[model samples]
Target chain A: MTEKSPGLFGRLKAGLGRTRAKLGGSLATLIVGRKAIDAELIEELEALLLGADIGIEATGVLIGDLESRLSRNALRDGDAVYAALREGMLGILQGGETTLELPSRGKPNLIMLVGVNGAGKTTTAGKLARQLQDQGRSVMLAAADTFRAAAVEQLQSWGERNRIPVIAQHSGADPAAVVFDAMSAAAARGLDVVIADTSGRLHTQGNLMAELTKIARVARKADPEAPAECLLVLDAGVGQNGLAQAEQFGQAVGLTGVVLTKLDGTARGGVIFAIRKKLDLPVKYIGVGESIDDLRPFDPEAFVDALLSGEA
Target chain B: MFTGLSERLAESFKKLQGRGLLSEENIQQALRDVRVALLEADVALPVVRQFLEQVKERALGREVVKSLTPDQAFIKIVNDELVALMGGQSEGLNLTGDSPSVVLVAGLQGAGKTTTVGKLARWLMQTQGLRVMLSSGDIYRPAAIEQLRLLAEQVGAGFYQADTGSSPVAIAQAAVEAAQRNQADVLLFDSAGRLHVDDAMMGEIKQLHAVLKPTETLFVVDSMTGQDAANTAKAFDVALPLSGVVLTKMDGDARGGAALSVRQITGKPIKFFGTGEKLDALEVFHPDRIVSRILGMGDVVSLVEKVERTVDHEQAEKLARKVKRGKGFDLDDFRQQIGMLNSMGGLGSMMKMLPGMPNVGAEASAAGAREMRRIEAIINSMTAAERHKPEIIKGSRKRRIASGSGTQVQDVNRLLKQFIQMQKMMKKAGKRGGMAGLMRGMGGKLPPGARF
Candidate 1:
């Protein structure tokens, strides 16, 4: 296993190595030789932004901003484009809250994790639960994902390994019923936090996604202010479709924050801007790797630095 | 999955439909639209640029005819390029050489790597009639091995458990030895997925690749990922001798840019696709059907194949005969039709094949799916006598069904009216011929305002 790098920014830089190579390095080379800011540079920079999966709407906004700056005689050289691009990216991500704000002291802060299938919702729930536990808060897990094969067992395995109590029903049970049970269990145990792992099979129209809303509604029965946070776990590679998922899930169950997983891979994580700009939801954390402690709080400045910090 | 692209291209071609000749400016304009579509679909920027360049050259130099519309010609050029970009035909696993052919599955984390292993194992065993064995090299996750073991047990594949204390290379080598001893026809190694492609993980995979000398090394990726899929596949291709690709989770709302981009970027064929989470959902990648589907032409062949595989022929023939004899279609028939649709990957997938419905967005499809489920639930809640005799179902019965199906009373009334209309249409077509006539008759009833 790779040890955690001492610096958070260093770990982030390493994690974003692929995106840096494709977007940052390419952008630097495209602009390095050119003295004047021209159509070619703008076009190549546009390509770079789109290549990073910065998305059409956001890229258009960034390029438009750069073009306006260019027209105003604000642009000087290649380094200017690089700085402008960094600043443009940061502008979108900066609006969202970087740190996870827990609910008022004594009560258990409930966070219902949601996303499409294979978006790392379960793993993120487990990691977040463990993180809260390590921070001296008593944490319990709700295995609300009883549909998928081995899903309940996966959550239970995390609970057992981390020594956190997991409230779960047998496989094929109603997920809402499972969360209800977990809520009761958490209240009885006097746990400080309850992280519910909701089903990610939102594409299944009828009962699977309906169960998420039901879980949220029932969680309130346990505590009026329950489910203090609803985090949508998005895979970094989800591209523009992440917007659709966020919109759908956000509208269905109000999203408090977003968790982008698999960020350490080839995904440029450009969807971060799209999610922030479109949904206006803060990215609470990013999953850097498979390790338990790899879950890091989202730091927009650090993330932007890691993303565009490439030498020509 | 490529609905967005198809719709954008449709719009672009509509602009060119007025023109007779393929002018350079018109071609460039349409190519620009194609470029945007590809970029939006998540095809890498560079690939999209190059693809549009080739398309531009071809479209400008094309020989136009009197019969073909300008739009049709443009679509043909685009379709041909798409088919060429993907490896032109379906490429299955190359497992002829080794007795226990080794297939190494590698990908980033949460890219459906482990699930693909199980699906591929099941597909090989059920479809190819091969004895399959499964092994997991993902020692990082505590339950990774257990998850694969359970999947193997569920699928009835041979399981070669790796020692958790051992390195990935050691585990893979031991699994290969066990597979040989067990006389398995195929051994699938499920390697660990790093959150990112780090040197350590790549080095580990490289070592495993050296020892296994696998027949095929498949890079599994999530289809929802846009340009990243191509980039990631290219990165992996640089380090390993990749045999092919596996695009997973086609069941999701992915625009399917990865399907278009990965092939051109990696220069490898996509061997299989994971349509759903089920073990039987793995399918051979068919380039022609995909190209047609992407071009908004609809994949009739795949649609027909799906029907043939899932629909009961004898039952269908019996129903056709019954309808021909003037016997009315009932709730039971309705249930069976809905069940058949469910079996053929549900309404969303079916809509992708029907003409003029390729670009059905997620919300509309979700509604369609919900409607299917509601109708099925209502039918299940019906009594045998009520199902057979709709005349016996009055207001009270309708209420009961509505409550039972968790739907409104209007829903029951709507369904019954729709059923009556369908019976009338089926009877009218039954006089002409069999089910083909029924489909043709139904097509004729589509609104005049409907556009392809």
Candidate 2:
């Protein structure tokens, strides 16, 4: 394996230096001028977005949109460039409304969380459960991740603190069976919501993913629309890797929405732009911390502001 | 079609080949290259802007480093600024808390959470000589408990696991109780990993925090995940009062922006690093070491220390003395050195610490380690006389050594040449001084390879 430098901050610092150098004299000129709709400025703008790793496809759309606006006399000057760029980027990002729709007339809205191994699926599940409880919803957790012995115990601990019920099975038991039991328990007890925590398996592991698909199938069997939201928890720090994961999980079990965990620690917040652009899947929630209330519903305007202004 | 930052910088340097001092135009050019590199490396845009403004202020009118070209001086300034942006120095784990301090491990799945638990366990056990207990609260994956158990065993730490059906909070509570009951010094609870930061996961962690109230909560992250690692760390930080970070898979070919970014973004220090899969492969993160590595300088001091510990000093001295006397340095000495190198963790890694040595590509570096085994094979093929006096054996002896070693004649010839070179060096060193002088010489040769 390649020995990458271990610190994200240092690499980013170096990365920034490179990005600045790439901007060249034109960036300064563009920044100083208030109104300038020149070809050179457009070229510099294109380089800037591409440098952000917005991916070529998204970059093309952003640049093309800006070019058309400029040609139509809709955009001019540095202020306009900033506004146009921000508006265009936000427009693409805001295409899909990022609200986690709660199911109406349900004792407990079941959200079946799924993702590949190491995708932060279980933590997202726990955080989501906590966030729901914090929102005044009585929540129950199900440790359906029976493949790992500690997984059930971990979820149970989360359940105990939240004062919620967590239905779990013995290690090595069928995960689908555990979720089935949990869902039944949630529905019977008139729980406000039941969050089923599943095992983290590799998306490429067909058998494992197939097993998850079966669990989803079994979950729907219990309540045809029980899993009100199958939130696929992805690490925002994963860059393009996370995008690939989103695509794979979307293919395997159609993702209702995405939960991007760890937004506070990465520079590739641009992955949000890519996910929005490519998958068109709405980001339902994001994890900013390891607290019960850390998971917040995705707000596009807020996110775009954070991306453009670095304030979240 | 697009140029990477490193390539672009190389091209720009060619344009300013004869410049004495950095003109505003050239600095702008260099900054452009730096900006592109940063963006490509997945740095946050705001951070990039802030950093560039600072660099521009510092770099605009400075004299270049003495005897260096304008490009080299610019590179130096950028490297220094890069180092400064990353908090300047590496921070370590805070074990200054009260005894039996709790350390919470937090991160997404596949971030090596369970494995980090083991690595930390071993580190505390061996380094601090503290009694460590590893408890898996990861009651999500079926084998999660077993994984921690296996890791605990590997690290020689006590393992705690509740039945798979048990509640994690109850299990955590019980494990803390168990740690106290067992008189364990440190209790490490490996929590369940998740795919995203959802309300449910946060609630669980919050609940766990209220119960355990760990002294140190370290968010484990994969450096390969880059910006995602930082984002997850931030989420965890807000959710739980994280004390530090443990970045895993530093051995992977990640660009390593996550390590630097997470701390700056989350205001947490990185305490430990998971360098490889082995239980002993964990390292205490030091910022200077990392910066040096990034600058392509080898970290020789650490390398030599490692060698000293692994190699038998007296035996090496004896071998050096023998070689100095023009005595036959045969298969026995070669075998011993090979054994020592192996104990010191492979020759390829040792070489990697030498400054200015080409990266030897991953494939070649791996093959280099295997080459030692071939050298050992050739030595093993030698007869007693051949082992003692390699000169006595001619072409027939080479053939015999090859056949006995299960290698070709070329292998024997290569070994002979290497052995002769070593002997010649030893003889020259002996004429000047002794093994001490040779070690000193080796030290001088070590820095370039070991700077980072």
Candidate 3:
């Protein structure tokens, strides 16, 4: 929304600057030494993928493909292997539905954010609300996370900063009731969108999952066809467990997409590849910084470029 | 569900059954499986490679123990190396020398820093009998200070916080003065969770560290964190002198590679682990227990320790005597039994430590706990006679008891049904000497506090 700033590709490239340095350092050593691309270079590539939170299965697949190509003499140098690895990663991400389609500016489009604790659901909600509001949509936030201490206040603070209204209940109130109230209020006020920030919970928590399903159900009671999209806020630093989180949350609430968080850090969040392989849910947006302005629509092309090239 | 590594290793190692001794060639197949398991557990590739090297050397040329399989011998070697690498004995906080020792808690955002502070306060008070004071320097996160204040209130610890808009150093300075004035033995300062890559935030924490001169700067980390845990912990260690670590979210199904990675990178003892969300759920880190878990051997030691620490010896003795007299397991005793699990970080945590036990998910076990509390409430509403003999409660009595407990009449019936089943199980177990017999099976591993 800040047109004066660097474009999405440049911003994400900058956010992922460290991944490029690390990967490029290893890749550079392999490519610059001008040695025959051997098993050692491939081993380093495998390590790079694994370090980026790409699961062993996918890393093995990529490495396996590289090894097979090596046998066939398909890859001549480290440069070919690098391009092949980038294309393979892009293959896992590019074909998925990458964007959220908004309903033409009329009824409220409810989006419920869900994830494990500390995945930045609240911060993403603030950023998303501001992004939508800046794009000419009236956004209201639903502080449905009544469980965590001060979660309501956190959302309210975001509302204050964005000059938006956030519907909240007492700290210990039922989160479903809070969502229902927000949806009803948004309908009354003719808001264009409602962003509900739910409490962070482990997907293995059956009661919490049931509570999320109930929230989605309650939103329908307030406004039919509510919660049009449920986004799982996954931390990029998560390893194989991200698969379980995605699977369980998808089964519990029927996740339409994912919002990968904390990508600004050293983590590449490559677990999204496995998540995509399992559920085919798009990585809609990413959180690149603590500032609200850092949320950007995910671009797989730029992300892959930064991850492999470290330069735009 | 991630199957225990032992079961899978046992399967693959079955091929090497005829081999009486493990040689470099024979253990190569086993080592590959182990490498994969370690990697799947989120252990960093570099750490995994180094660990495999150590495992290979120790596993090679070792005779299988009498009556123990070659796989068991190999697993023992790997487990021991892991424990040794992680610092074998349990390490306590360095709270000596000063009257008001400050323990500064820092970590990544949402890594449970404030919650760990609350748990640490309770742990210090319970173990060391120290009068602890809690303070929050987390000015960035909304209502973060209030969160710590509430936790302090819950734990009976004095709370301190600076005015809004004050920098972290100012809050630490003010809290230090307050702790001295209050004569608090320990001042637990909780800082805002920040990323190690964020230089500005890192600088702020470094500034706070300079101002407080904390006796212990514990780095709190989530157990579910991945390979980057090493880098993050290394960065933090480079920025501050991290005395130890507190790994949180152990209650989840994370493989806990972060624990190994953090220890490998920082070379610091993991002082405690946040087992559950409860204040009393913090546990002292045992290398053997975590290594057992990492190797998929189930942490029976920690489970027994949990039972020993949380189980009230007196209550168990009374129940044992009552059972020995054939007085029958009553509703009151059943309620006590339910409360025990609820107190000991829920049945979910217990399930995780038992080998071959199905992890019925934290949510399901949490639901089980809720059911226990409801049943306890129903028992509390009953009169002494009704508790002693649940059969005496007629239809109207059931209705009255249900309403008194804020539950439905059907809920009362459900409790009655469940209690009958539990009573039968308790009677069967009681005939084997009850709690005394259970601990008797533990040999001398039982803690001193646990008495027959």
Candidate 4:
């Protein structure tokens, strides 16, 4: 979207400015003029990681790993400690494969975008459509979010901008019915990918949770293995509550991956590690900006570098 | 979700209770729990660290009171700190400007900036009796302008139209000029937001601020953003002179890091809270009440305020007189109470504002709403004779009512049970201290199985 998109690392660094300012800046101040990793240093570092919205479980694991490494004399200095922290972050984030494996030909890759209200589910779906379209893949978008008054229009605007076909019905229509029609259309038209936009409902809403299950069930009717990727688009700004959403949404619709959005905003993006460590779901994409090109594949190394390179 | 911090703090205090003296080790352990509580609430890590340092300084070496336990004393100290950290009192809008006073709203994309603009406009018009003008400078998004225009029309505010063709600065300038021409009391500028904080977005907003020089620059942020809300508010504060913040979607399940940290981090008061998606769901931010709310202390003041706004005094007085006369509270009375609760944002929100009821989540609130609707439906299916005298409605009548209400017979039965329980409670109230006793009892506990 710029004259030329910045390299992944550069964009990542810029994308994580706020978080880096919070973590990297604090870490630098904490370790300044420090000769060794002492109890006080470890305590400060632990506070920093926990503060970044990294789950207590993930932070505990990282701290435990760091402490054991320190006890073994592997972590001697601040530099080693910083490296160890990076490695610890990567360890939690690196499990799932980053690449979204497309299914073999004959059936379209149906990616269902779901998350709680105001998590940018529709926007992420649009940008994803553009990302796939840029890859020379024919994409169709399903405006299945009939709950919000503006959701359908928002998705349609994205479809129109990207010049992708959008399957939509009237507002307040059954979202499951809309998804069913979109899948049928995608299959009929021989589209390479079908991105479905679900209505943003709080994970706590039971009826809405049931509606999501119904949507997934309806998608299966169109194709036996429909909704190949039920990507949960989580707002990185969400705190411990992200864990609850991930658990509940995972149980309801079966999340395959996560698309962490608003990373460019105030969200520290630390919740990705929690989502990974807890749910075993790889963050398929990270939205860094409003543009289509801002959606970058999640690279654990790049993310850590961005998050820790504030002093640099 | 915001209750997580209070709940976690409560757990820590529970451990400290029955302790002989507050030793250094015990204090440090308690501080660690408090740090985690702040962090889990999405308070910025640095803010959490500094907050703990202050709390530790104030809490340590303090003499224990005769009556209160060390844990209670520590909690009281923490509660005081929480209130101070959030601006100790509500700072309202600066409306001292001449006609066409301007209020500029800014925030990240999907942070409910536009909706807050509409709600603020409606609030200004209805509550403050000011003619408000609304305009959107969010040119990048395809329907951003249209969305604000629709919102303005819905709220009956003066709309200043701007298209994507114009620059954000130009849009702000035009909106101000139009507001002057329309003789509007206040002009609200809704600026565009990028998905991330970028130079282009901030630069444009800063330029708009310079041009408009609005009286109030409120950062509209999603409360769901947790700690990021404070950080993002800080970012905008650096760009523009932010006077206050609007914490949107407080009705949602957010850990409330933003509400807790925004004032401390940015040194700006949270002006209002966007409780729901509806236009009228905005509430004035009360720091002490919010601190109390966060501490699992019900905001009785706010509840009373809401009651004053929603309840019909004449009808309430009539009901009170009937109850005082011991005429008995019936199904019709229960239906009216349920309707009143629904108007006051339902049982769930009411339950949330109540103290010692932190576990009543969105799911429970929604279930309560569903139950209320069912009861209302069943009551609607009842004859006027049956409503006045429940004794006449036999098993055959219950079956007919259930069918008419599209509910199972058991649902009607459950409603009857709930109604009977409420009737007994009302009778007890009438026999004792009357309305004051009923009001006091309402604050103590919610009956486990009663739906209405």
Give the alpha carbon lDDT tens digit for every residue of B1-452 in model 4.
36677677878887898898777789888998987777777777767777888788777755444436777778887888888888757767998767788898888777788888888999989888999999988777766787788788888998999765888888888888999999999998988865335666677778899988889998877776755665576778787898988888776666787776777878888889987667898988888888887777777788888877887777676666666665666777767766777677677778867777755755666666776677788999999989988888888999999999999888877777766776666666766654464454343223334343
- Candidate 1 clashes between residue pairs 3 or more apart in a chain or in different chains: A264-B196, A265-B195, A265-B196
**lDDT by residue for model 2 (B1-452), tens:** 01122333455556667777787887888777666555554555456667788777767745464536776776667667766766644555565555556777877766888878888898888888889999988765545777788778767898876866888788888888888888887889999875433557677788888777788888887765643444556678888888888877665434455665676777677788876656887888766656555555566666767667666779888766765675555668767766777777565566656666425344454566567778878888888788778878799889888898888898788787777766666566666655564453343222112232
Candidate 3 lDDT at B29 equals 85
Interface DockQ per candidate: 0.49, 0.13, 0.40, 0.38
lDDT of 3 at A220: 86
Chain B vs. true chain B: TM-score for each candidate? Answer: 0.89, 0.83, 0.76, 0.88
Worst 10 residues of 2 chain B by lDDT: B443-452
**Model 4: CA > 4 A from native:** A1-35, A74-84, A97-109, A147-150, A169-177, A205-226, A265-267, A310-312, B23-25, B61-69, B195-197, B308-322, B325-328, B331-348, B356-422, B431-452
**Residue B121 alpha-carbon offset, candidate 4, angstroms:** 0.9
- Say which prediction, candidate 2 or candidate 4, comes out ahead on DockQ: 4
Global CA lDDT of candidate 4, please?
0.77
In model 1, chain B matches the true chain B with a TM-score of: 0.89
lDDT tens readout by residue for model 1, B1-452: 67777777878888888886888878888888888888788887777878888888777773455437778888988988898998767778899777789999998777788889998888888888999999998887657788799889989999998665988899988999999999999999999885335767777889999998899999888888876776677779998899999998887666788887888888989888887766888888898888887888888888878877777888777667766755666778767776767777666677778777777765666677667777778878889999998778899999999999898898888778777777777677777666675344334332211232
lDDT of each: 0.78, 0.67, 0.78, 0.77
> Which residue ranges in model 3 land beyond 4 Å of their true spot?
A1-24, A32-35, A309-312, B1-18, B61-69, B308-352, B355-431, B436-452
Q: With candidate 2 superimposed using the best TM-score fit, by how many Å does residue B108's alpha carbon deviate from the native?
A: 1.0
Q: How much does candidate 4 score in TM-score?
A: 0.86
Give Cα distance to truth, residue B147, candidate 1, Å.
Answer: 0.7
* Order of quality (lDDT): 1, 3, 4, 2
Sort the candidates on TM-score, descending order: 1, 4, 3, 2
